[model samples]
Target: MDLQVLDFPGGKVAFTSKMQFISETSEKRVPCYRVLDDYGQQIEYDCSAQVNEELAVKMYTDMVTLQIMDAIFYEAQRQGRISFYLTSMGEEAINIASAAALTNDDIVLPQYREQGVLLWRGFTVQEFANQCFGNKVDYGKGRQMPIHYGSNKHNYFTVSSPIGTQLPQAVGAAYSLKMDKKSACVAAYFGDGGTSEGDFHAGLNFAAVMEAPVIFFCRNNGWAISTHTREQFRSDGIVVRGQAYGIRSIRVDGNDALAVYSAVREAREMAIKDQRPILIEALTYRVGHHSTSDDSTKYRSMDEIEYWKMSRNPVNRFRKWVERNMWWDDKREVELRNDIRNQVLRAIQTAEKCEKPPLSDLFRDVYDTLPSNLHEQESQLRETIKSYPKDYPLDVPV
Candidate 1:
């Protein structure tokens, strides 16, 4: 019996198809592709693509919702209403479409930028508001910052600040799911920058060796913070990382909502039915800063951002497809945007007025039994709050 080794770095496999196949002893596996060009036309892939009016409209609505939320939250941060914010300005399709393909039982391990997924997964606007504003109603209390929303109901893991950590966690979760003989899988989302981390490799290798059901979804938006993909890696893309793990992988146009949805739908099917871990590299671009904290202008030019905006706008491309199919109207689009904006504004206003989580709420969840040292520190902090001036925001009952 002979085993095939793919030398991705040495250029042994000819990178022609969405997936390259090697003649391993007996079994054969293949990759899937569905990419579209700037004109909303298929470019690199030519498989039988399927999308209908309902899915198209749903995708459009999700994209619009994400855009509206992103725009408002950025302004909220600017107005000092929120401590931190992250936007999925350009990568809307990659997040929402991929999420649209998952089951309610499937777990989603998302990085900070995939706020769109939660919203699409029945996370009400008010829940988003509560989480972002860190109001009394917030599930995590006031611990996580804006957009770090999670829900057990949705099977979406909480978004953590550390990069690439979710990859391994997703692998472990999938391992558990498989051990329990469940059909559900875990889809972990990460950025191209995260691909450089050791966690990415460890997670992929574990999933591959264990045959865990997980989807390693990478949004190759060309930048990892201020660094470009060329700087982060020299391989074909994040997809090749999947090849190294001997996992089935796909690459799609991240801006094309249909392609993204179709690719993920197929990937999810493979994951659940075959217990295969998949790596999907969505070739997209980040049209915004690394976050509200960093100025992209420091590292990239205005011209570059403008280039992606005009030519590769996911919203615009999807809108074009919508118009071409006559499933959407310009007047309705305007009205929808206005309605969403007003909805967000009202949610924000209500969330802002909601009481902050009780000062003691923070000390409750840390341990089964609080250590004396931590209890003392918590007490000292409470005392300091009690010592604040009457006008201070500290409303704890001392």
Candidate 2:
């Protein structure tokens, strides 16, 4: 019944006489921090001081813009104008508010659903359309599919389709900033499902060991494609995982815009100050299908989706907060929605009308000088197209 300290290879340990194991489930689960209630009323604390009229208005407006843009783009996919599309219907607050909290210098490695981050970084709807449509003027040269947006000028990395790949990459970037003594951190955004990937665990451990300044933003929207969080893991969500890696972690109500902004702002400060990683598990709902390819109703009930969409819609929630402060009104709401819709429509129309990238573009960018094999293939392709003119479209430049 005597307590004794044990020498261990790992580190110091406090010996205890009692034998106990950590339980998977706890009566007092990790609390999710939230600044506003579902009705958009600030409960225990008022965040109006930090979230001013101008900032609040801009956050709400950007959320609406993202919502509208998603709707238009999703429909465009349905109409066959674009190949594929994904909508950030309910998670608008997470995208816009978190982005507003960080400086432009901070690097962003986003998953596919983070279009709002690009929008916050001044990426126009035209750019979104160009990429989705894979038009001639598209920055990616029509290589990637829709929504794989990246802007070097904005310090945001191009989105990769592979799940959880950005997690470790963010840590590497953060480590580079640490080495350079730069005043910046990397923000890596991923879904709840991404935690299951090996990269996620590796990335967290690396960041903790290296004392890298990075924000691991997990948009725990309850689902990863068709799979629900119930199927992902059983350890009380992703926050505790961060604790296991010796990194700071917090869970916040992702639907609450002000809460997200406040949390990210403080997280950034602590991340850079301490030269460590911070994991933010944002508790929100995926109110839309995972992508245009998915029909969410097949896996989840319409009533379930409707509940989050109607009662806890992030955009509507923030709008209420903004209106309560007299920062928003119905006239502005109407104009904002209409103007965004028109802009989206015009962008889509122009993108659709634009030509595809030239055929020669396919061979460029890989190397300074094309290899003999590639040059031969290019010549053969040109000859084949000439022979079978009907097989190829004439619009692509020779």
Specify the highest-lDDT model's number: 2
State, as a TM-score between 0 and 1, how close model 1 is to the true structure: 0.88
Candidate 2 regions exceeding 4 Å error are 1-3, 46-49
RMSD of 2: 1.8
Give all candidate RMSDs, comma-separated. Answer: 6.0, 1.8
- Clashes in candidate 1: how many? 0
Going through the candidates in the order shown, the clash numbers are 0, 0
Candidate 2 local lDDT, residue 4: 67
* TM agreement with the true structure for every prediction: 0.88, 0.97
lDDT of 2: 0.92
Worst 10 residues of 1 by lDDT: 23-32
Model 2: which ten-residue window has the lowest total lDDT? 1-10
- Candidate 1 lDDT tens digits, 81-169: 98888889899988788888887889999988888888888898888989999988989887887888889898989888888999888
What does candidate 2's lDDT look like per residue over 1-398, in tens digits?
Answer: 22465657986678877899978777888999999898899878744338889889988889999999999999999998789999999999999999999999999999888999989999999999999988888888888989998889899899889999998899999999999999999999999999999999989999999999999999999999899999999989999887789999999999999899999999999899899999999999999899999999999999999999999898898999899999999999999999999999999999989999999888977889899889999999999998998898777887
lDDT of 1 at 214: 97
Clashes of 2: 0
